[model samples]
Target: MKIAVVGAGLGGLSFGACAARDGHEVILIDKNDEPGGVMALAREGGFSFEQGPLILTDLREDEAVGGFLASLGIHLETVRDDRGLSTPDFDLIPPEEYEGPDWRKRRLEELFPAEKKGIREYYRFYDALMEIRFLSGEKKGLLNQLRLLRAFLTVKPYENMTCRRFTEKLFSDEKLRLVFNGILADFCADADEVQCFTLPFVNTETAFDKRIPTEKKGKLYYPSYRYIVGGCQKLPEALCAYILEHNGRFLSRTVAEKVLVEAGRAVGVRLEDGREIRADMVVGCGSARDFFTELVGEEYLDGNYRRILRDFRPMEAVFMLHLGVDFDPSAFQKQSLCYYYGSYDLHGAVEKLRSGVYHRGSDGYLIYFPDRHAPAFAPPGCHCVTIYTVCPDRLREGDWESRKELFADELIRLAEEHLPGLSEHIVAKKIVTAEDYRRLTHMKKSSFGGAVPIWKQRNPPYLTPVKDLIFVGAQSESGGGVPIVLLGAVEAYEKAIRANRAEGKGPAAGPV
Candidate 1:
């Protein structure tokens, strides 16, 4: 079987690797000259930075990712987070400050110490929501039914409520509410608009009881979190190399302009240059919107899928300021990620953000100093820092093109307040905005890719309306993030392989 995968992002590469190893001839295509998609590495002077996700966690508890890297003879160092906070800036709080109960509980207590019982009950409720255990029918009990009924009546799970609503109900402290809202920025969604169910699930996946320490602090590890020493891009590069070693081919700088469909089945793809490559199975590791509406043509799509794609709102975009400074954050002697609450009212902060207004008084900022863990990321006596914030995708009155410089300047000024004299220590600095992201990655709205991962929309979410064409990646059911994207690729390949075998073809080759 000949399989063609569009977009050589992590998802695309994973699909290619899986199919190639399964005994099929696979061809991976991408418009970028290299793989890794948004996960690409950026180097300027002696400083190296990860353009997209800075931290990688193996949430699935599977050894597939790490084992795959080891097969390629690559050894990755595991890093752990010594202290956790709701925000990115770690310099503000002391290590002992996080010592009481879990941060979530502490945050609740801080917010509603007067309503301590209510706050504790809220945590208990959140815990119950996260504790999902699949039991056989024989194990059913009346207690479980009562619990389910209570949840359905009080939780209002069907209302699509936001984190703000939950926080308001659970606590009244202004600072605590802001702390909760600060984390909401991480999801790139306004707290009031983001579904409440999204919060607990993300909390479980990222900040549960799982905490491991490495040789360095502020780095996190799971059973499978691994890094490709040269940088994260090396993983995808290695996967591409493996495919080639197994007689599979990778075509860089080739964009899949359209899906080639014959008799309602995906035959292959037509490249941007009008060259058509035929394949037994075609998998799209790109946006579902682009795949169906632009590439596949809306005529082939059913109304439901089209409506879903049209109505789905993408996650908010971010503006990142990557700086190479002459100091190591690890040596600074701070122990946790910091969350600075510049505003007293969390709802006001969210409203300001949604309205596309920058709060000039917002001293509250998120900052990450990677040199605290990965020293190899920077030169001697220097550190790499990424300052990020969720900004409006479009400037007020659509003047972003003319106002970008002003925005960058304001961000730098904001950083100067936290890292006194930070402007002088900068050896290299680069700013990436939503527009720049779109131009570079070609993702819609330049979004970080994919919708928020909530229970309602898990990985491999809706089945595409088309019979043979499948969608994967952040834009599909995988719900973004590196690990989920990789898993989505594997799932798509498994389905494609099964379909091929059902058509009387043999299994594709496995990884070499």
Candidate 2:
């Protein structure tokens, strides 16, 4: 079976490599000069930028990602033992910010000492939930769900209630509520809009049970987190190597013009170079909208089906700024680990963004100094940083292209405020704007990958209206981040096998 996968992002690489390993002919095509697509490595002078995916949370002991990497002879070490803290020694930074698994509970103890017992029980419940899900192989039977129904309803509460409403019930202080709010902000939705299940998503990220460690005044504090030994690019490069070693082929620097579909079935893909590559399955690691409306053509889809994919909203876009500095970046690592501008009005800031505004004063950003843990990122005595946050996908002041440099400059200024002299230390830099994201990652309007994690789009199914056409990547609405994207890739691979079985085709006789 010849499988043609479009886009060489993490999702595509995972599926293609898995299929090729199973003795299927896999041909991955991407417009980029190398593999890995968006997850691909970017370097300048002697500095390397992680590009996409700031953290690779391990999930569980049986995490498919670790297994997949092991199969490719890639061993990842636990990197960055770190915690979040208020940075830059500023007067505005809340003097008592916290990080790590213990921070949440410890924070409540400090601000609302009376709620200490309730806080302990709250985290205990969530810890058990993670255990149960892990035991169920991340899937629960009907009986299991029914048995857990009461527990689910406990945290879940009313379906539409946001994190603000839910957490306020537990803590009255707005700062404490905001402290907890940081845990779920990845959803890109307002605190009030974020759903309940996010607790497990945030806590169960580790492969092993993390025994909370004591935090000292100045050290990184988390017990579990995996950073690439050398750089994040190692992941995609390893996947590509595995696929190639299994005899899989790749068409690099080629744009996929369309997916060749006939009689309501996908046959192959037509490249922009006028070359058509035939395949038994077409798994697109790009936007779902692109496959139906652009690649396969909207005429191939029914009007109603087309409308649903069209109406599905893209996740909010984020601004990513990577800076390579001439000075030792680790000097600011303590501040960057999870530094946040304090006393923020998260809900109000998010609201302003929806109205096409930049609430610079109200909104806070994340700064991660990779070199502190992974020195391979920059040459000796130098460092690299990833500064990002959710920003409006569509801007108000000017087009993103025209305004990108200014936005980056402002971000640098902000970084300077947080890590005094961050501006002077800079030697090289790359700014990823909404427009750059749309072009590089093929995201819809440069939206971040993954659904908002509400009922509708959270963990959306793989099967599509078009038979044998499975969608992977952010637009499918499965939760975002590295682990979730890889999980979707697993679904895609399994579905491809089943699709072939249904057609009376078994696994390929040998590797392609």
- Cα error, candidate 2, residue 325 (Å): 1.8
**Per-prediction TM-score:** 0.81, 0.85
Estimate, for each residue in 100-177, the C-alpha lDDT of model 1 and write its tens digit.
326556644664569687567566655455432211122459876765656555555434566777767766765555
lDDT of 1 at 256: 84
Best by TM-score: 2
Worst 10 residues of 1 by lDDT: 213-222
lDDT of 2 by residue, 275-385 (tens): 999877887866776666788777877666676676665566778788988776555544435646544566766666676775442367778776665677788778888
Query: To one decimal, what is the Cα RMSD in angstroms of model 1 from the true structure?
Result: 5.3
State how far residue 420 of model 1 sits from its true place (Å): 1.5
Kindly provide the TM-score of model 2 when superposed on the true structure, using C-alpha atoms: 0.85
